[model samples]
Target: MDELIDHSFKLIAKILYFLVRIFAWLIFEFLYEEIAWWLGWCICRAITLNSRPTVGINGYDEATTTTRFVVCFTGIATIILAGTILAIYISANAT
Candidate 1:
């Protein structure tokens, strides 16, 4: 009985660890840059009031300093937002 319980706990731990790894990969590898670029584009469009193209005439090959700043800011903001939500969730669920 004790062995069975120990095995079950280990399995649960492994599952949780796997899930965390996948989540981290999704956030850091897959979604972070894409989300940042999208948000930055939107913010730039808003700031420019759609008066001009945010991208260069050469297309996305060029990025203005302001655009870079917006992208970096949005990326950091996203990390902070995710951390805040995770903290709230963990605290709420804490025993």
Candidate 2:
């Protein structure tokens, strides 16, 4: 009788495991494509923003533009990349 009960419990646990797996798969599979597209868009935007040429307004010296642009781009790219990495780490840890 004890053996039978143990076997039945094992079977129930297996079923529950499979059910959870299936549910997670369904949720992720449905959202994966949209999530990928949005992530790609965000990365592309970040890259473009970082690499775009800087337009100087009044009082801006052409000689200093390149240096300033490089500094700004480096700072912005660093922040963006760091934020993205942190977000991914947080999400991965959450799961």
Candidate 3:
């Protein structure tokens, strides 16, 4: 019985993880380009606000940085979110 319950929980966790990954991938695929461009532009503008000459960073560099940042941010967020949801589900279902 204990083994069964443990296996069931593991299955649930796996399903949740898979669903979250799919959702995150879909969102990233559809929005990363535009979001990266906007984020890069904003950061560049802020950095060059008081300077006479703009930085030499090109769009590709900005996009790369933005992509890294977004990926890290989303990865952390997804883990936290999934953990929270799993905790809540387990707590509610616990005896």
List model 2 lDDT by residue over 41-71, tens digit each.
Answer: 3444477774433332221234265544454
Off by over 4 Å in 1: 28-31, 42-70, 75-95
Q: Which ten residues in a row have the lowest lDDT in candidate 2?
A: 52-61
Task: Give residue 70's error in model 3 in angstroms.
Answer: 14
lDDT (Cα, tens digit) per residue for candidate 3, span 67-86: 55644455455556778999
**What would the per-residue lDDT of candidate 1 be over residues 11-33, giving only the tens digit for each residue?**
99999999999999888644545
Top-lDDT candidate index: 1
Model 1 lDDT at residue 15: 100
Model 1 scores a C-alpha lDDT of 0.68
Clashing pairs in 2: none
TM-scores of all models?
Answer: 0.43, 0.38, 0.37
Going through the candidates in the order shown, the clash numbers are 0, 0, 0
Q: Which ten residues in a row have the lowest lDDT in candidate 1?
A: 52-61
Q: What is the C-alpha lDDT of each candidate?
A: 0.68, 0.57, 0.60
